[model samples]
Target: MANPEQRPIGDVSVPLNTGDVRGFKKEMGRLLEDPLGGAERLDQFLGLNIYTWVELPSILGILFTMEERDMIRHSGMRVWDRDSQGPDQGDQKWPMQDPGWNNQNERHRQNMSDLQWMIIRGIREAVPKGQNLGKAVSEHQGKDEALEDWLE
Candidate 1:
């Protein structure tokens, strides 16, 4: 059996309903407006000693909620806005007019990868040069896909 602690990226796609998406979007908007507070909350979530803040560019604003953050803490999945390609278009979801979405599974995968990278990048920016922050972020990124294999 595959070790429960180790999961592949393909296995970590989360099944988010419309409501989950909406709530996440709302919180992201609020967080964008207040980077410091968001950083504090994220630091809490990440259990990091450093107080790092990010000024979410107006073009980039999608983020997973604290609740969902906990839900997928080690699940290797995340919520993201795939339509705008940046984060401006939360209104366009899967099976909508967005190009190439085509199906629900595809949509979930898009957001999962996008959000995961966003989280990784956010941490990379916050960590100082000598702290081996990349290694730190990779630890979480390297966690075995504890979530169910969604590739099937």
Candidate 2:
């Protein structure tokens, strides 16, 4: 994998665009809205490319809201530290760690660790099987990389 800092979040072996933050966020929302529907398109977008590098800071930006930015920062730190003992250890990684916030013409990614964790915690608490989806998404979508990705 590319150096963590230089790793373009867009190349995580998943389909995405390495571009600006805003459009990438919007596209991510759309993809998450219907991953299956977006899967084909995303796959095509990525083409034959493999081994995508993540952009930690940008990932946090798109995934988090202003109110939760600090929390995301903390989560990112935990990710970098390889501490499975992260604050919200059991929460999902994708949409937080390896978020697919990309567009066709973008060249970057963001980490929304805090907001995603909150959503994961909230959803799980609110619904009996909600937690399952979070884990499932991360695993199926290939966001489950080593914690070291965040550290570099």
Give the number of the best model, judged by TM-score: 2
Summarize candidate 1's per-residue lDDT along 1-152 as a digit string, tens digits: 99977964343323334454345455543433444455454444333221112222111224645543333322222233422346433323211232432223555445433443444434333322344434445554325665454222
User: 71 in model 1: Cα distance from truth in Å?
Assistant: 26
For all candidates in order, the CA lDDT equals: 0.37, 0.41
Question: lDDT tens string, model 2, 23-87?
Answer: 55566443224433333443343334432225434443564455455543344344544544454
lDDT of 1: 0.37
TM-score, every prediction: 0.23, 0.24
- CA RMSD per model (angstroms): 20.5, 17.9
Error of 1 at 63 (Å): 5.9
The C-alpha stretches of model 2 lying farther than 4 A from their native spots are: 1-19, 30-63, 83-152
